[model samples]
Target: MESTMTGNASGKKKEIHVGLCGAGIGGVFAAIAIARAGAKVTVLEAADHLGEIGAGIQMTPNVARLLRKYGVDKVIGDNLVRFEELNLRRKDGTPVGYTQTSRIEGALDQPWWLVHRHHLHQGLVTVARQHGCNLMIGSRVVEIDYLESNEVTVRTEAGETHVFDLLIGSDGINSVVRRTLFPAVKPRPPTTNCAYRAIVPYEQIRHDPIASTLIQKLTMEVWMSEKAYIISYPISAGTDFNMVLSHHRPHPVSTVEDISMADLRAEYATFDPRIQRIVDMIPNAQRWPLLVTGPLPSWSSPRGNVVLMGDAAHSMTNHMAQGAATSMEDGAFLSVVLREVLAARIALPDAIRLYERERMPKAFRKQQVSFLNGAIWQLPEGEAQRARDRAMEPELRGEPLLRSPNLYGDPATVLEVYGYDAEAHAERALQEWYNGQDWRKDEGTGIEAPVAEKVMNWFLPEKEKFVSKI
Candidate 1:
């Protein structure tokens, strides 16, 4: 590993050495940002190789903003599928509501993206490597000795030990790092649902009449019913169609385990024929038990040098699809904090405290709303479900409102959730600490065309980027 990870290296003694456990979205995002901010970061990933298992994930405007600014968006390029529309339907395949995504994207000055989880992970890792961040694959943290030394000593499962000025646990929900940091705090109860994510290659079904026609829609079509919802969309640059089948379970499963195709078919036997056909084509899927965690007393060590990010700190359901984005936000916010501390603009303790204080409330909102979103989708088949369907009328006509039944159609909620900028928030936090001038007065006031929008407009004059309104 290089001695420095920045455009400018002093070629002298290092200022700070940061260690990160897990190279998932949050850890890698932090690695890139922190390295770019002028620090050395060593990533220890437990996996034998670097990759993502899940097939599909969505990135709202808030995450898109960070990626675009850091050039990760460009790196992913055409693999990114900009959602043009989202359709809500009943279990019988009856249309309930429809909303255009461009309106929200335009309002936020960022694009809504759907892509293979591997693509997103690869982009982040590429950028992190480019920034000179050292990646130690197959190194899983087994022990931490922060109590005895000024620096943290992390021994991996393989018995190799490494030292760092700061240790960040960006590992997922079952984080060993988080356990060491907060010994006795119990994890939140698991959600009463499990999600089976599967991808069907379009090439395999291009000859089938029903499947081929539906696969080319390029929109997220969600089918809702009592206690379950199925979300499907194109991923892997439209070569694969991704499906997320979430259903209510009386008791949560113990862990992510292999799911049988016949068992999955039985679970969704009551669904529409189209859904059944897709499930039949799925070669494999893992049943993932959704979990909610944290709002713990804190996410840092007593010494404030060892910290938790991503699922290590907070894990929520996928109802809102903000799980991964929130993880990335942790790293993005920390980048700003570390930048100030490295430049001597803020004290390390105060900066860390600012991160803990400011991020807690924001994270709380996400955790709660994620549960709320699940409730709305999992409404029982009754008058209440009908009433919810009626509330989606405005969005069905393409006019999203402040409080639409379709949460994504509600502009206010979209802005509140997707318009968040962690880096900007970190900036604001520092200004408040010093009672400095406001730098965000002009931000969020105007919409500038993103690079994709500009090129898309020029290349495909016939293809309108946004339809109707902003």
Candidate 2:
């Protein structure tokens, strides 16, 4: 365990020690980024094994671009299925609209991909290990203490205490770190939305004539209707088909239970014949309650030494498929700020503040948009639904679906969400902080000075400044 202090005997800059709570996609990715930025990182995972339980995850270009930047793209790309287009259909498999992802690929300079969650998780674990990040599995973080010396002390359930310069709460929605920091903030109850997921072997589906053609083209398909929607894509290098069916419930289910194939079929009885056939092929499915968190007043602790990332900060609905992508973006941004802090270009507190400042707004917006997008997808039949279908009819005529007026208010079309550059945003923030443009001013006197200067001066020697008193 290396300390985050400088002034070593070798005359080299001391490594910034970072402790991350949770070793899911967000934590592992953050560890890799910070380790590559020349910081020493340790990830604490409560699970005995480092793996993902989900069937598949959609990787948009925004996330792919950062993975490429970290050189982990190849690892994920090797096992992923690249789709050329996204198809929106009705319950009966009638084409409503389509989006050529090729356009997105060309504009973002990266391809969109679908991958098995386990494969992606394993790939990230390998990359983080290669970058020298220490992974502590089965070590649940039960408590966190901010020491008076400006260090964060993490205590695990295994009775181990580790001190670090900063602590990142990348734990998922039920984060203990977040609860310890903000005890009064309770996550909103699960909405009426519930998702059922299952993976069927391509071989099983390929034997059927109707399903065989679906696997051949490598396309992401969505069946939208009133009160329910189904999204299916090929994963595991097209060997398996991942499916998720989100439906509205009149009342919330108390627990996630194994849903038998017969019950699943009964639920989708009104769906298209193709969907019924696919559901029949699945042996079993798991029901997952779609839980969302209300916006928190802040993502960082009062001291700014501890902060939340990923779902711990903003757990959005999976409507836009930005849940994992946004978390990876958080990792990318934090890496840049940590690198600057390690190089002495900025203070650690300022780096963390900048991270929160840059990420909080975008994260909250994604949360809101995810909810809204899901609502639009599950719109009931009426004049509004008819208008939406009419708007989508242009795409069937070879026109761009995004050009439809109906999609103007949709967050999926927002360039900031889809075309964000995490690295560039981080670099710009650091540059501004370095140029003294990000300084805070006294309300009454209007005296200006970098917030980093004020925080650093409390720990280090004071330096001469333009304005002596604020």
Candidate 3:
């Protein structure tokens, strides 16, 4: 296969062709960013349609600023609900502490938005297409072959073969690209937590004396309790309310299954009466067990050309509400790094290395933070639980909440997570990597090394057995 380089109107740099394995949020966002950076991108989606499931996503300022830069925020303008605060409360409806979204926006220079997943997905699709991204639906990537020419050939289930300079695995947790890269690693097992999700029309609850209060104002509410937590907020311009209830269970069930309202109510029987009333208003709901994977030793393939992002790289629970936000950040970071590679300012291997080096640590950190947040939310009834409640009491009294620092820090640290700019981070990493380093030699060698040898050398210095397989 021969490499092809197309020039833009200004004829500044060669356009890099990027093959994306999934057309979900991350893939589509990456497509837009790459196209905006003057590259050609094609997204392969397995589904026949380009839409997201029934759910709501919280977009922090970090993600919002990137979306604005990509023009996605304009496409989704006013169709989203902006919240002033995130209200935390106990299961009994006692107010804990609150994070002022307004304050965060003032600090970050962008608003916090809650939007329907479908709305966000549709907006991204629109903006990506506007940037001339080729979105091929019903095309599932079945296999990927890294060629000796420093190119990649992707074979879809439809038997069509396409070659590109880079291949990205943005296909969520069950990513085919991820499986192909690490066949020894098994599918992630289901976590002990199961979630019930539903969307109720605002009109349905607007007239109810108790339920109407939930919709009278716009705020993201979280109710924490022993072994369970509930999150509810308005989405789709407050025409509907999206709610998710997660609880610990003894055994794992199917990821998604039809669940009865009675079952949901029984599970949250100990919750506040107001919460129960809201649960009763759910016309339909589905339960799914959360699934997670062990952090991969590396997100990139041994060859370094093929890599993972978003949930494909690090699947975490929703406790932090950063699932979609972090995926957007991944796309932003990858696009910036690839722009440097395509411009010939950096070698592909070094670029990929820098991308992984900057992203892996942060992604893993967020994953651990998300896990810890979930644990805090679901602490069982005990002395530990009482202490947590006591710590939250100050917040209830409108005082600055004092939290005992542990493995994970305070809410301020979470605010820092929201303040991160992925694009800036990637650019800085690139600068640092090129500061007196001779990356040109690796570039001259076509960036090819034995996959097994590289993995063994990097991960297990003493293990020479894996090198024999290469």
Among these predictions, the greatest TM-score belongs to 1
- Higher-scoring candidate on TM-score, 1 or 3: 1
Evaluate residue 441 in candidate 3 and report its C-alpha lDDT on the 0 to 100 scale: 23
* Lowest-sum lDDT 10-residue window in model 3: 401-410
Clashes of 2: 0
Candidate 2, lDDT over the whole model: 0.78
Candidate 2 lDDT, tens digit per residue, 1-470? 12232323444564678999999998899899889899999999999988998799987777887777777777766677787777887777888777777867765567788899898888899999999999999899888888466889988889999998889999988888889888887665357888898899988987888767676778888888888998998899888889999887778754576766677778778777766788788887788877666588788776668888898878877888888888888988999988877776566777777888888888888887778777777888888677777888877777654455223222346355666778867876665565456544555665554443334322343444433431
Record all residue pairs in model 3 with backbone atoms less than 3 Å apart, i.e. clashing.
none
Q: Regarding TM-score, does 1 or 2 come out ahead?
A: 1
Candidate 1 backbone overlaps, count: 0
Candidate 1 lands at a TM-score of 0.88
lDDT for model 1 comes to: 0.80
- Candidate 2 regions off by >4 Å? 1-14, 253-255, 405-414, 436-470
Candidate of highest lDDT: 1
Enumerate clash totals for all models, in the order shown. 0, 0, 0
